[model samples]
Target: MSDLIEVRNLGKTYRKATGLFNHKEVIALARVSFTLQAGETLAVVGETGSGKSTLAKLLVGIEQPDQGEIWYAGSQINCSEYRKTNQFIRYIFQDPARSLNPNQKIAEILHAVLRYSTVLSFDQREQKISQTLRLLGLLNEHANYYPHMFSGGQLQRVALARALILDPKVLILDEALTALDPSLRAQIVNLLLELQQNTGIAYLLITNQLRLVRHFADHTMVLHRGECLDYGPTAKIFANPVHEFSRKLINSVQY
Candidate 1:
């Protein structure tokens, strides 16, 4: 596999009102660096304020970094290039199907993406929708159903279908599996692994699920209070965490 995404010295800051005439700069993420290879899985783990979401936003073009360079498929991109980046790197919100339109059928929801993102005609769009839906183990008929009609596991697949519909090269899974029960999470994990095996779609799994990271990720990035505390192979980091904070984090979870 070759480098698919490269992030160098990424940083983000936010200004919050502190007083009547004063504001404070809160560094959400700073000096973060990493690379993701084609078909590779990189798990980003951190606490609430560790800037995991900030990193996800930057990757998907939802937000721009204050300082740093993001390279995709060997070319550089900034916030303004989000629409272009979006076609290649897709994001799935943590709320699962709730991110979907309650009033729209699945087909309509997916059709909207194809209708705008590509020039595919109605027939092509319909064909692509069938293929994408089936790719996530959903039937074509389900596309006509509303999100509320599906079970929790099925809803997760619908969300996956939305992201996969674009045929994106990379997926920024922004804690997408957090809400699923363990059994459902396991099924989704297996499905994702299968997809990666077949499609070579890389994943930037921004999540707090260390167990998932330990078993599923090729590498792990540990973030703490807007800083990268440690980063390395999953086995190496789990067996011998370099930083005290990292050790504490690993110890917090049961193997």
Candidate 2:
């Protein structure tokens, strides 16, 4: 698969209050770059404040970058507006419980997405909703239930269904698995890999979970203090890390 997403020279800075009238510019991400192919998983591992979330926000247009170019499916997107990438890129938050609307039934939630993103008729939208729910291991009956009715694992499946409904090219998971228990996380991981194989959707998994990174990621990019410290195949990074920080990181995790 060719590169489905290309990021080049991305940079982001935030200005925060330092004193009464003073502000300091903090660089959250700096000239970071990478590429993701169709059906591939690129795990971005970094400690807190390491720019992982910043990168995710930038890619999804939650925040505008200071300097960078992001190309998705061969089209350069305006990082300032999420609508520009709505059809190709989607984001699944860390807390699946909170990502969904607690007030809306699952069917209503899914229908809203279809209503805004597609031209499908009401019947078509209903059909698409059932299809998407089933695709994510959810049932049509569950569609009548509220987000609160499901367990943590089921909530995640609902969230995944919401994202998959769009047929996105890349699904950016910002610590998406951290909130789940190990068993659920493993199930979600396997489901994600299966979805990748079946749908050819790329995944950018941003998290500090090294175990997940080591096992599932095709390539891994390490970040430290907003800088790219190491990057390449997961096997190479584990067998022999290039940066000392990476060595320490890999050693911190078992297997």
Best by lDDT: 1
Runs in model 2 lying further than 4 Å from the true structure: 79-81
**Pairs that collide, model 2:** none
lDDT of 2 by residue, 126-173 (tens): 998889888888888999999999999999999899998988989999
lDDT of 1 by residue, 74-141 (tens): 89896678887788899999997669999999999999999878999999999999999888888989
Cα RMSD (Å) per model? Answer: 1.0, 1.2
Q: How far does residue 84 in candidate 1 sit from its true spot (Å)?
A: 1.2
Worst 10 residues of 2 by lDDT: 79-88
lDDT of 1 at 11: 96
Cα-lDDT of candidate 1:
0.91
